[model samples]
Target: MKTAYVKVPFQFKFEDVPVPKCGSNEALIKVMACGVCGSDMNAARVEAQDWQSFGHEITGVVMETGENVSNVKVGDSVLVESGSYCGTCAQCRNGRPDLCASGTGLFQWKICGFSEYMTLDKQCLIPFDPEKIGYAQGTVIEPMGVALDLFYTTDIKFQDDVAVVGLGPIGLMALRLAKAAGARNVYGVVRNRKNTARIKLAKEFGATDIIYTDETPLEAYPFPAGGVDKIMVTAPPSVIASTFRAANLGAVIAYIGIDYGDRGTISFDANYFHYKKLQLRASYAVPALYFPRCMELIADGVIDVDKLVTSTFPLEDLEKAMCTLRDDKEKEIKMVMVRPELL
Candidate 1:
């Protein structure tokens, strides 16, 4: 079997290794298609002495399953969870599996989706009908689950004004979901006009307005009703304070992002937040709920996976794909790596 790994300064390498053995409660999945994430890009840039395994948004077919595994079987098409909760944990027993602390590591697999074959606990597999969804479309479910989590954190009402900071895949999807949820004016905020493709897609995906921070800061956007009813930030933490400036009074702001060092620390007006009665919420989708509903949304054409997945490459071409995604921000959206034969 062959798997992909990355090193600091954005380098990629491949190695051939023995196929992993499936445990009694595990299933072996033949890789089909895997979505490259912003986090994966972050991982590639992190300082590390050895190559680090990456790629989690995956969709594949079950080639083998252990005798004890009943949740999935051979020939089942599924979306693999990047991590899962321990069923016996207190939180899991109480029905809040997302809060379980003991199962935070990547399940039994050594390397994830960027491979020829991978095996994982049966509990992490969510079967989908292959006839209805293509391998590439199947990979979008996990990220949509992520976007859905951010949406759930906000109280967006019909005709409400909503703004999403950062136009990454998750951010773009969040804005689209806002439009489908009935937000009268959906705002897509970007740092500059260099992201022409994404800005155009934002409007196509139902953004009623676009805010470029380079020209006009978010806090001074002249939004109707003084500002938007709800705001979702998918950018780094550094941008959260500015995003808060664009929120309407009594509005709720939900965000999901990560940063290290100075960029992670954020500062905002305490008096402003208090006087405005605004709420700030953090959305971290783990044990990753909402796959079924999100899949339905994609299947029903409410969220078009095809439009978001702008490019696909063979696993061998991952370096080329990553370079395009990083340097060619204007033309790239979501990039996927696939095993042609499996697909």
Candidate 2:
């Protein structure tokens, strides 16, 4: 088996290693397609101290099932939920498995989707129809699930005005899901002209308006004085401050972006939130329970996952793909690694 490891900053070395043997409750999945996530970029940039394995948004076929893994059989197509949670944790007891504190190190040490094969517990697998959704489309379920979590936590209703900050994959997915969920007007805030093409596609997906921060101030948008009813921040910490500024007094602010900094701060009028009763919420990856619903949505053709994918590369070109995603931001959206032979 061949695996790509981020041994150090900006360096990826491919090594041939023994294939992992599945445990009694785990299944061995042959990687079909894996999406390079923004978090993977953060990992490659040495954001975390551990030697993190790349690729989490993934779709694969079950090659071998363990003795007790009856839910998934050999040849079943499925999407792997990268985040793990202990079913008995306090957060898990409250039905928020994504925040399970005891399962904090699942992505840090265990195998990731970057390899030719991934060993996942039965709880992390969601069966999907490969005929209805391609491998590229299947790989987006994780990010889409994250977007779904944002909407699930808020009190958004039909025709509500929503603004999504940042045009990353998750942000774009939020734009699409918000509109699908019945938002009247959807706005996308982006910093670079690199996302112009994606912004245009966002319109097709659901965005009614697009705001490029490089060209216009957040306050100058056409929204009312209080601004949008809800704002989802998918950009870095710097942009999140602006997202807070543009949000309506009583609006919901969902922070879905991953920030590594601790120095940035937002200065907002406390009375605004107190008088209007604003809701500030932080959302991470989707809960495991939502995976089934997300998979059904994808299988039903309600959300077009294929359009979110901008490019696909062979597994051998992992480094080149990373560079293209890092340097050529304008030319790519979501990049997937496909194993042609395995398919």
Highest-scoring model, TM-score: 1
RMSD of candidate 2 to the truth, in angstroms, is 2.4
Candidate 2, residue 282: lDDT:
79
Residue-level error in angstroms, candidate 2, position 304:
1.0
Q: Superposing every Cα of model 1 onto the true structure, what RMSD results?
A: 1.6
Question: Candidate 1: lDDT of 217?
Answer: 95
Question: What lDDT does model 1 reach?
Answer: 0.86
Deviation (Å) of 287 in candidate 2: 4.2
Candidate 2 wrong stretches, greater than 4 Å:
48-50, 88-99, 102-105, 224-226, 263-276, 286-289
Each candidate structure's TM-score, on Cα atoms with residue i matched to residue i, is 0.96, 0.91
TM-score of 1: 0.96
Q: Lowest-lDDT window of 10 residues in candidate 1?
A: 100-109
Local distance difference test values of all predictions, in order: 0.86, 0.78
lDDT of 2 by residue, 1-343 (tens): 8888874476887878888898898899998999998888888885746565777888999999999998899999998877667789888899867678665223543677889997888877878888877888788888888878877766578988998888777788778788888988888888756766687778888787788777988877768545888888887666655565577767898886665556345566677667767788877763433677777777676677777888888888899999888887676778999987633
Off by over 4 Å in 1: 47-49, 104-108
TM-score of 2: 0.91
